[model samples]
Target chain A: MWEAADTPNVTKEQLQGAMDQRFSREIRQRLAEARVGIAGLGGLGSHIAVMLARTGVGTLHLVDFDVVDLTNLNRQQYFLPQLGQEKTHALCQLLRQINPYLTLLPQTVRVTEENAGELFREDPILCEAFDQPEQKAMLVSTVLEQCPNTTVISGSGMAGYGSANDIHSRKAARRLYLCGDETTDLAPFRGLMAPRVSVCAGHQANLAVRLILGEETP
Target chain B: MTVTVNGQTQEGCANVLEQLTQMGFDPKRVAVEKNGEIVPRAQYETTPLKEGDKLEVVRFVGGG
Candidate 1:
């Protein structure tokens, strides 16, 4: 008995076999359609990028101008071999390896007020992983004023002597999520820790997924 | 005498700092704008309240 579902290109038996083997069809479909733009390739950015990539984000626009240094080994996921490599480039390579289907666009340039608009014009959502307060503020303010329709999620104060519970999400304004500490504490500048950065990155990735899924988040 | 803080009308009191504290705001975390000008944190304690004053208190939140 010949069945149409057993076509050579996409056999129903093969498709059913794959479906029965791993992730559900719905999850695979979502991963193929999702496009995420990550701004910053530091500790938080690196973690977020990898998580999103593994989860099936179809395309990733990674923007970062800095190069990897010895200090970054403590928190960033890059290897010592990747030293001197641009953060965006290294991250793109790593993410692509995780999921070969992922389309990675690495922008090896700093995200400045002059270029942020053009950089984000194509991406519907923006994930801010900047470590400097001034830079974060500039990005957030610009996005709010210029690209009103696009959603911006900015990370802040994921450092110092704080429990994972201290990290939180606050809705500072419409389509803007302020994640991490709500204080001007500078302890993280002196010494960057892994737990805080990882927790914050997790929160940022979680929020991004929630937003894309049309789920309510505070 | 009424002053609005976050859209709520509160009775104008003698000391603005006391009123803000009573309203459940930490003095250090908030910035006060009186009559369109930001009142410095130093002035929160001495600043007096007036009738029908519209005060916008901006709080600092962390992110970078």
Candidate 2:
């Protein structure tokens, strides 16, 4: 368990140096300059953002309109004190704590077809982490049809406490990659759990990193 | 005609839209890709599923 008192005060240069020791100079440079857009700050989005930040993704555009609620605590990357706070704002705070030098763009608004293109126009890769089926389909369709240059990484069917191994990533289309079991659906008996959600989120985040590194296939 | 959908081969000649409906999928809640190219939702009705065409129809569900 980490406490504020135990937090080590480190300079940005020192942190960058530490990261440089792990990843090749070229890889770290690419990650430090990559601008990625993530829509939705729910279970998958929040985790994906944090992972990207930890991996040294320099610029991230986090979009979400919902607020942290009691129900979101089970699988979301938020604490009890963050209840009622907008997801975008709360996630930005957490991400800043991870990498202060990262460029964070937190947008607290519902992403629709009209605004998604404009919001993610500059990003080469867009992660679709919306919860509802309609929203997911809408965003994927919007990006694929309108934003031809942006590759979409989407999550689907990561519900229920099923086998974590069942959740895997795949190249769904030419420019679209999907992460999840691609079959499991939510239900009263098979509710969304933390382990499986994180497993799927890991796939999405890892896939994003791979794509950033020019590894197209999932 | 035998067509593969999501890795499962099925015997049908239905177009993308008709095949999705027959599979009990909500047309508005899924994205379809045929033969390595994305079949836009607007073109689903006109996108013909030829024999041996590979189709990847991904349906979004309620989760994060």
Candidate 3:
């Protein structure tokens, strides 16, 4: 069902080479076959999406209801030209440009507890990248309560300018993966900047990749 | 009283719930550990904090 990107007729061998020697061919193959979902398209979600795509992740199920705004330019991976475009569509374009072979399912709708079941069906692992705590909790709890097989990787407290060392990844109750400083709150006293957000995003993406590669920390 | 919360010692506050609120943590979003034992959310108000009591309170943040 997957057509070659162009008439040159590229092969899986070259696709694997995109990952190069840094990642094993076996890992690349595994990544190529893995299907993952990102629940938000904000700073964290966009970064995770890019990292996964660059790692040769074959499929991405992206959901975002918002559009690119000038404010998002500070941290999110989108460019200035992408402004005013629907975030899901803009992100899909960026991802496809990076890896044309990627299979992207971009849904331009807000995900709520009611639709969480339908939105994330069949994906083995989902990254919780919402900017709101209630939304994150809803997706996490909905999937865990309704669909027992799905694993959720979520971030919390990754706000404010702080030391990267403050951020950590913890396996919370159930199958939830929490990545962040665990204490940084977005407040008038503190702000959500790029460095700390990226730190949490890296942790979330790393855990997703590690899980796909079949590594269990326990 | 002094309690070691999230690895830092803090003075005042007698119970876990009170100490959390005093420190600007919303009890609703955080998971608390007292001396390595995970405390049920229901007991935060009743769980008394004593001198040298070590506590680990972790909460989720919003960004990205």
Clashes of 2: 0
Give the lDDT ranking, best first. Answer: 2, 3, 1
Q: What is the C-alpha lDDT of each candidate?
A: 0.72, 0.87, 0.80
lDDT of 3 by residue, B1-64 (tens): 7878867889958888899899998776666667765665557899898889887765655666
Q: In order, what DockQ does each candidate have?
A: 0.15, 0.62, 0.26
lDDT score at residue B53, model 1, on the 0-100 scale: 77
Best by lDDT: 2
Question: Ranking by TM-score, best first?
Answer: 2, 3, 1
Best by DockQ: 2
For residues A1-218, could you state the per-residue lDDT of candidate 2 as single tens digits? 24556667879889889998998989999998898899998899999999999999999999999999999989999998889999998898788788878999998998887877788878899988988888899889878877878999999988987788888899888888989988787677776788888898899999989999999889
Q: What is the C-alpha RMSD of each candidate to the true structure, in Å?
A: 9.2, 2.7, 5.9
| Candidate 2 lDDT by residue in tens digits, B1-61 | 9889999998756699889988888988998878877777778889887889888888887
Two-chain DockQ for model 1: 0.15
**Number of residue pairs clashing in candidate 3, backbone atoms closer than 3 angstroms, sequence gap of 3 or more or interchain:** 4
User: How does chain B of model 2 score on TM-score?
Assistant: 0.90
Higher-ranked by lDDT: 2 or 3: 2
**Which of candidates 1 and 2 is the stronger one according to lDDT?**
2
TM-scores of the models, in the order given: 0.72, 0.90, 0.76
